[model samples]
Target: MSTERTTGPALVVQNLTKRFGERTAFSEVSFEVAYGEVFGFLGPNGAGKTTTVRTLGTLIAPTSGAATVAGLPLSADNGVAIRSRIAVMPESPGLYLRLSVAENLSYFAGLYELPDRRARIERALRSVGLEHRADDLCRSLSKGLRQRVGLARALLTDPQVLFLDEPTSGLDPVAAREVHDLIDALRKRGVTIFLTTHRLAEAEQLCDRVGILNTTLRMIGRPDELREQLFSKSIEIRTRAPLADPDEVFAALPGAEGWQRSEDGAYVLSVTDADTAAPAAARALVTAGADLLALTPIRHSLEDVYLQLIDTDVEAQQR
Candidate 1:
């Protein structure tokens, strides 16, 4: 576990803006990731997710705005000083295929000049479940093993902040799950994580608070918070009968908005609150001569929130 250091903000950005030509990738973007926080950045394609990550990683300079990392100004060393305090696992990491796992870690460790280098390397290998393959070359390792090596590379820095950009992208489900387990372990060790992923479900599972940064940040909160914001006190009732016209049935409950049919001709009703709306909906279904088979609250997942935000923006632009 990491020993606690100074109690200050881990990373802070204010009015961060980046632009090129006539287009602006991101503007007026600001957020604070406190120590031990697993902050997530979510957005659709070209919504500036990668651009934002690149700027935060200090790989590129923001057009305007100020950011302080680990209590140091971001420009002192052209971001070098801040970069030293952070480790990054890019979305597509380029690994040295000819180098053994241990060698790869040592190569990075040597650059960072970490103390007790060999011991740190060994500890990181075991931490990511790569102890047995420490001697194997990267080229011969499976995709999952290679990912562990990438993580091991980052761990060599002994950084306070770890930037993971789509850390589990394109891997098999099992490998992705393993990556999540590693993240969980890292969080327990008190490493602040900034995770960016297109995978809404994974982000929902791992992030403490997620910011949907499409064009602008449409929403920022935990998965459950987003659910409550987008679907507060709402429920979907699935019935066995067609109930072709649900408007006449629910005219009294005018707050209900979205109504649709399930694949089996079962109908669904969207309401304000399940606790109150659900019982009334169940009664309404039965009164309408519709066979009520399942009267359960409909859960709006992160994907639902993501899609709604995206579609809502696209629609706004269309208008």
Candidate 2:
């Protein structure tokens, strides 16, 4: 499915900071998430990711700064109105253990004061593929199933914005995939998603942009852009046979920063520019009588970029 980008950002945060007395949770965190965008919020625990979400969700107030959710200004006066336009599935499912799935959803639907509560409940359950288990008590469901039920509950209000905190945590592979599929479906419908996940793979697969927060806004951009910013281009070449002395060939290549061989015998060459260095490296290897099998640029994983950023931030703070 495709989304039209004509609409402005679904959420806008400008230097938003929140503090509790002397403790500053996060400071000057700013970003904008366009409509239909899945913006990933990532940070280590105590990094204030949750605080930022709570502030945006209107559960807590910001100390200073401004934001708008769905074009509505974020303030105490707008809290009730903002809640109506958004749904938050917190780290915990927070379902009533004794209640049936349908009952738990119905309870929240009532809180939202949604009309046609029964129809809305059914639709939400179906959205998460949990209609068959509607009558099952919440306690009886497994962790993954419980997660789905919580998701269904969040959807009952047909929220324009969704906040999911570790929505797939503790689920088996199959269940996690189910949640991922549901998230994909939501994005197709133009629902803005604010996701906080420790799973870098999931963030890489789903988020349109990511913001790293650690007591302050550290980095915010598309995953690829952040990766490129934090690391240089690299190229990997697999040879038909290992060269007698690979170091000499690699050292001769222009713009070659460093080189290493993997356990599988592929040469990983760090270069100033993969586009030009790749060809030169290939020629250098072939000239040395090494048969070439494959040559490809390497894209750093989000995890790699994230760790590097954290480390860099730590060192800077120390100095």
The RMSD of every model to the true structure, in order and in angstroms, is 3.3, 3.4
List the global CA lDDT of all models.
0.81, 0.87
Please give each candidate's TM-score.
0.86, 0.88
Model 2: residue 172 alpha-carbon error in angstroms: 2.2
Best by TM-score: 2
The alpha-carbon deviation from the true structure for residue 149 of candidate 1, after best TM-score superposition, in angstroms, is 0.5
Runs of candidate 1 exceeding 4 Å displacement: 242-267, 280-290, 314-319
Clashing pairs in 1: 233-272, 233-273, 234-272
Q: What residue runs in model 2 are displaced by over 4 Å at the alpha carbon?
A: 1-7, 237-268, 272-276, 291-296, 315-319
Per residue, candidate 1 scores C-alpha lDDT tens digits across 187-206 of 88889999989888999899
lDDT of 1 at 201: 90
Model 2's alpha-carbon lDDT is 0.87
- Model 2: what TM-score? 0.88
